[model samples]
Target: MITEQIAKDIWELHSRLFDHRPILQGHIRAFVKEFEEKRGTREEDRLNKIKTQLNDMTDKYIPETETALDTFLTNIQAKVKVAVEVCKKIEEKENNIEVGFLDLQRQRRREEWDVFMQEQFEKSAKVDQDMDIEMKKVSAEYEELEKKIEHISTATP
Candidate 1:
């Protein structure tokens, strides 16, 4: 993208010079030629310096960013895993309580209530699992974007 823009800018500069053809005739062309050569050399040097700076910036950030991402992912994964386990344990305890209540109400018509409660518990578990999965996917995508941003910032002047 930067290359294309640079090419377009150069073309526009050339076109502007040609548009004033009469004014740029004879000695004017020689003078413009010298000026352009000097400008081109200066621009090249500037671009090289900018490229070096970009390289240095990228070198400074890449490893630090990678380490940060790795640490973040590990922390999030560990926390999520712990949360899911705790949630599962809580769900099991709730299920056991429901079962015990159902047993006590076995003589009564509580079948519908038992079924509804079980269904709700299952739905809640499913929702929790889905949310965790979504969060993991989002985290992965964020990491990828970070990498892409770093690559683009480094590659472009």
Candidate 2:
């Protein structure tokens, strides 16, 4: 098929690019040019052909299968059931992985928030202690001034 042919071509190109020995600049340039040409040529035509073939196969095969004998119908039905089950399993696994990843992210964020709150609390406590010390010093100085005023007023009398 075209897809199989494309896969083979891609593998061939990959093998050439990843050779064990040192690759020359000239070889690299040649490969790049070849790849670009292949990519640029007839892409639209190739895609259209693929689409047309798929549509044709679907239109041609499905109704014929539906109207076929019992054995053929049974086989197609079995294949379809298997396909559906496999798809459902894949979807379930994907959902599980997503849920696990989200839970991990939430836990990490919670830890970060806890650390931030602890740091802020420590800083606030330090500020409060500093303010308390300053208030005590001011109060002592005020008491000393009051004692001096009392002594002065008694001596003048």
Compare the candidates by lDDT and give the number of the best one.
1
In TM-score terms, which candidate is top?
2
| Candidate 2: C-alpha lDDT | 0.90
Off by over 4 Å in 2: 1-87
Candidate 1, overall lDDT?
A: 0.92
lDDT of 1 by residue, 14-66 (tens): 98876776665877988989999999999999999999989987898887899
Every candidate's lDDT: 0.92, 0.90
lDDT of 2 by residue, 85-130 (tens): 9999999999999999999999999999999999999999999999
* Ten contiguous residues with the weakest lDDT in model 1: 18-27
Pairs of residues clashing in candidate 2: none
